[model samples]
Target chain A: MSSDILNQLKDVVLEFDIENAEAVAKKAVEAGVSPLKAAAALTGAIREVGDKFGKGEFFLPDLVCAAEVLKKALPVINSAIEKNGEKANKSLGKVIIGTVYGDVHSIGKGMVATLLYVAGFEVIDLGINVKGEDFLNAIKENNPDILAMSALLTTTAAEQKNVVEGLKKEGIRDNVKVIVGGSPINQEFADSIGADGYGATAPEGVKIAKKLLGIS
Target chain B: MQKGFKRKFEPIKILSSSQIEQIHSASLQVLEEVGFRYDSDKALKLLQSNGCAVDYETKIAKIPPDLIEESIIKTPSSFMVRSRDPEKSIRLGGNTLYFMNSAGARYCDVDTGIVTMPTLEQNNEGVIVSDALDTVNVFPSYTPYFEIKGVPPVMSCPVSCAQRMRFSTKPSRGAQPTDTFIWETQMAQAVDAQLMGCVEGAAPLSLAEDACNAAFYYLDAGFPIYIASGSIMGGSHPITVAGASVSHNAELLAIVVLLQCIRPGCGIIANNFVSAMNMATGDLNFGTVAVALHQMAYNQIWHSLYKIPINNTGSAFSNSKKIDYQTAAEKLPLAMCSALSGANLIVLHGGVTGELAYNPILAVIDDDVASTIGRIVEGFDINDATLDIDTIKEVGSTGTFLSTKQTRTLWKTEDYMPRVFDKTSYQEWLAGGQKTVIEKAKERMIDILANHKPRPLADEQDREINKILSEATKYYKKKGLI
Candidate 1:
């Protein structure tokens, strides 16, 4: 039984299957497998992916795929811990992430994603070409600790406000902290966009996320 | 301060959108009726297809305004001007401002200090790569200011430039091969084997009658040619500030129209510098206030006319000392005005002194200042949130605003904190180094040079560079460059 649980944790770490990570996780839970060990295994793998990104050994598609793979494994890994009465009911924190509309670029968002992961926060990325409604939904759904968005194009920076206004229309204003980022973006634009925080670089983004979450 | 701004300068006009439109219309009129002369036949063909009247006799093309505007929109507002030698490249039109030094030719000032007609060591070969890499904002071969070290050729040839770098012994001899159209029969290849390209400064040469014969050369061994035009008002331009700006604008406009006549999307920089030639001595004086105004006007007009991102030469001082009122006045206004005018670059900062006589230094303060100055130019956007009137009233204007969330948000993002000028009490100043900005800058220089590890070059490339610098060493030994 012990070996079976370990094997399931390993498979999840390997990202061998979409449903299998969750299914095997459930099986491990039934067998009374340790939740922390399971989490440690996946976190270790994800950390490797993150490091590889930092080292330039991996590209954007690899990052997106890895993020997706991690996404698949997270719930399963969490559910197993919940079953064992060690549920991560308290998350490190939450983040609402999106690409400002009109900007098809996603690398900045991806950097923020990896940074949030390394810093131990749950980030809900709304993906590229996302409009204000999408942000509203993510904020409403996740009730995240920080709302983050990025736009690479100068023309699309205006869309950042549209997202903020969208949040207002939905009556969820001021409930979540918004942090804005991108290449052309400055503190001025971020403030103008009504975001709570502005980070110039990816590392700074992590710092902002942690600070916003009251996580020091 | 904002209201008093007009009192000082009569409020230099910020051209309204309509005024911009008028300028564009005027430029188009110049292109179509006044006509631009071209050196290359291919450039002429490109212009003719795009609604330009091509006159083979003068190698000139007159383009319509709408067409030029259409072509301008296609030009990449942002681009990475790659360095073949330097491992890093700087992005033009990116929010980041790149820097280069004040590299125009040095002639005897006659008044303050004699410029002593600078030679190869003091000019192009000695200046190129180190000058490009020492600061930032990618510098093109200041065509005339090509090298500080020895290189074989500075002709309109790519192989020649590369060959020179490969043969030089200097630590920083390199070139990013750019396409330039020579006579109708020959063209310099692009640095990359795969891409055909051109830089903007070569416009004047490419838009001439000689370019016709070079056509077959480009067609066969063709590399993309980019042309750029530069005008230094006092040195080679009109004496009046506005007059100088107008001359440069006319030159740039003429050149681009010529290049567009040849190749529609040819990259260019509305690159121009307005330097004050000490009226008495004729030395390049950067601190003169008129040059700042000239640069500001030139940058704004170019942006308004082209809509293409511009790379303007900004702030530089001719003094050997890195910090002074000359440095302060010249560097500050040049940087600020360029930023306000949205210049993609301001090249001479950090370790640049004697009008760029010194390149390497131990201090990084200049670099720090340059970086801070760039961020300062980005400026603040004031809206309801920035005003935070409610927050202000609740906290009370007289009370401390430091503890507010807005303050916290702003303080974190503040790009500059002026430190060289001591603002502390006299006692505090005594406690620290009782030094002025120049002494502080010198100390900072020591710190940077002591800490930096120059980006390394490939062994083969290094060998080529060494061999070339050795030749320069010999040349200098004969001529005493060091």
Candidate 2:
């Protein structure tokens, strides 16, 4: 029963079946299958799907749905593991990301956040029009390894610099590595804003996040 | 038949009646609930006086459904743009489709297909080639202004308008949706041609004051106005195609209402240039399957319901910076969809990479593409003569009729013959040095430039157009725009 339920959890992730993933996770807990074991199984499936996506077999929508399945199943399994007084596992890293103020663009932010989460980071997405104070608060609350900000408009790009200045004001500038990106962002702009790194794309964002956290 | 003969053909419809109504109803809801703002004081006061609920502080105008409906009804279904030569005039609306060469590129490089600021001579060569292309029916309102020397980049609009007026007798449009372009339209009209200009709407239901004033200027000048929306999804509009389309529709309807209010029964053309923003780059993405579907759906919705002619930037926009396979791949689907869906004025005959670059070779290739699409849109007639029952009976038992009278008479109109695309045998092709479509297009372009001469503007008309140019330059110089 343990092996069967564990394999079923992997199947749920591979099939991108969020509802089935949640149901199977609950059933795994009820049947006395270790939630840690179920989570490991699901993570394996996610890695395989991510690899396939890297090989171009899957598209953006496929990766998004697969990530969603894992997301839905995680809570059920995490609670079960907590009930057993055992931790699931350590994540690769934690990230706080948002679109800067005056820009209501969410797709790029959502994309990087999803990819980072899929790569095993604990991501706290602040969503669109996030102010500098919100970034500072999230930095204080989450103690994130990296803080990423995106702004599509040239006008809103100044907000990225504002957030960096806010971090400096709180004396937390060195606590977290800051990464800036968007359509108009470049390495020069990133350096000018005192960002530790800049990502031109979502996948590149993931690599930068992992590198900043010293995660393989 | 004349070379580059313009004709009418039925457009293909891809949406259901219920779906059309769904979009319409959704659009109307946007207009009433989430109104777009107009930045123009003149436009807002006009709308407020016409019983619209106007918030002067925000400049938002929530137009009633009846007002939008009435304006749509008042817009002319079709209008003829007469050229200096009566023989070259064409109607824009109904089943008619006119392919115009792309305008507004800062560069015109063909050899390497790399974009750079072109010289005036290169730009003039482009205009002359466009005049010679059979598929290109009319000159667009704007062309690449910076490419031409002597005309300050700021004065390109007024300067290029005069250049096009002299280059071709084909009726053209203006590039600006502002009062500055209004003067050019006025000049074109004075030179015995009516120039149409577009007035763009700020998406999410707003029309700015400048665009509104531009529309009014053209209308007041007794010229037609193309109500355009350049809404980029996920940026200026909602992320979803349908949502963005709703915003576009609302903005267009609101502008139409303002036009009707300002001058009842003014000539207005429906134009949607809505494109999605690429999430990866945050750039305006014009070459995507989603964009093609959006254009097709827009044509279907507007043409079917409003009975207004549709104009879309078809096959003219691409993200590919060069004229290569990617450009071809991106262009064919868009041109095909726009053609099949039956957009009335399909612009961008030879545009590449978001239309920041123009090449005459690409233009010639696009002419071939437009011709093929025009033929496809000109779906064959199915009456007895085309059905050829008698001919089929006479040619029974697999008899050949290559030399028959019917074959000879129908061959010209029955099949589309591409001028630049080759259909030669492998041996003949190899023996002829293996020319590619681009190579052949380049050769054709050279031939046209060397030999083809556009009908010259009358001497008196030339003087008047020059006088208009000098006056415009002086006026713009005083304004410090040049």
- On the 0 to 100 scale, the lDDT of residue B223 in model 1 is 34
Worst 10 residues of 2 chain B by lDDT: B1-10
Task: Encode model 2's per-residue lDDT on A1-216: one tens digit a residue.
Answer: 789888888898777775576888888889998778888998889888888877867656566777878888989989988888998789888889999999998777877887888888888988889988989998999899899999999999999999999999999999999999888888889999899998877888888887887777
For every model shown, what is its TM-score relative to the native structure?
0.49, 0.66
Tell me the tens digit of each residue's lDDT in model 1 across A1-216.
776677656555444343465666667666766777767666666677667767866533344444555566667768767666775635578887878778777666877876786557877777788877778877777778788889888899888888888878787777988888887788878888688888877767888877877777
Candidate 2 CAPRI category = incorrect
Give the docking tier of candidate 1: incorrect
The number of the candidate with the highest lDDT is 2
Q: Which runs of model 2 end up more than 4 angstroms from their true locations?
A: A1-216, B1-11, B144-147, B393-395
